[model samples]
Target: MSFQGEQYPGVKAPAAETDGFRLNHTMLRIKDPQAALDFYSRVFGMQVLRRLDFEEMQFSLYFLAKLEAGDEVPEDKARRSVWTFSQKGLLELTHNWGTEDQADFAYHDGNAEPQGFGHICFSVPDLDAAEAWFDANEVEFIKRSDQGKMPDVVFVKDVDGYWIEVVEAARMADKGD
Candidate 1:
């Protein structure tokens, strides 16, 4: 898997030296905060870790993550903010005000022409069960687990049509590829 393209020479940052560096979160713009929050919570079992509201700016940021069974979120605001920042694999949902009321408003889902951002993924315990649940809940599937080149994975859409890839974590581990 190689491609020929123009290359530029530049000094590389010392990524190896950054001891505490980690990918903290990925942001997705949503038109309706409630709808997006509901979809994520219901489908992915994610909980809101923290929320930042900017009234003057007319936008709110919701940080969500799938916490483990025994994990607890800090109750203190400052401590919770720090704890949230330190955690990896967070999803930040940004909702701009007034977009929900605009019937024709929508955010570019990054899957059509001029595509850049692709999709976010989740590893489930059971692929078959998850697919069945999605179908029962009336969730739209872009690709089913039994279809596509990667037959073991499924892709579903959110309220805003953002693609989410779901796969069986145990099966993926067994593949060992």
Candidate 2:
């Protein structure tokens, strides 16, 4: 069955959503996005639906739903736009964005020949304390937050030479205060 309570090979068009619509997902090249295609996903007796993204949303998960004869789902009405930002960063990883689905990963690592990639960031509860912790642990610093014109922003180099940015949201408030 479909989201609109249609039967198998359902010929009727999706109902004009009154509440809203969800973007569910978008895929490129030789692919189409619709309930018609969505229904066909059950070829494998698919109870699980995989939402696609060219980039990130959940960023680490493919939201799936069971497509059986009867299963309820979010009522999409406004031409599909609800599934925009997913539960963000449940499984944050050290890899390039938008390539999570692929097996082989190619990276620029923010340096060397094919250079473009930069760094990942982390927010700490205490910026000064975190910096002190880094120094205490002998972490290699490209620049401490105090050294840069962009104060309160710390840059530390990992063993792999990739830079990691550390920030504290409270610092913005600190400046304002």
Highest-TM-score candidate: 1
Clashing pairs in 1: none
How big is the positional error of residue 116 in model 1, measured in Å on the Cα after superposition? 0.8
Tell me the alpha-carbon RMSD of every candidate. Answer: 5.2, 17.2
What digit string (tens of lDDT, one per residue) describes model 1 on residues 1-177?
265354568745447588678999999999999899999999889999999999999999999999998877889988999999999999999999899999999998999888988999998888999999999888999999778777788999999999998988777755544
Per-candidate clashes, comma-separated: 0, 16
Global lDDT scores for all candidate models:
0.91, 0.49
Off by over 4 Å in 1: 1-16, 173-177
Error of 2 at 69 (Å): 39
How far off is model 1, as Cα RMSD?
5.2
Where does candidate 2 have its weakest 10-residue lDDT segment? 27-36
Q: What does candidate 2's lDDT look like per residue over 42-109, in tens digits?
A: 22122323344445332322433324355344456232223223322221122224453454634345
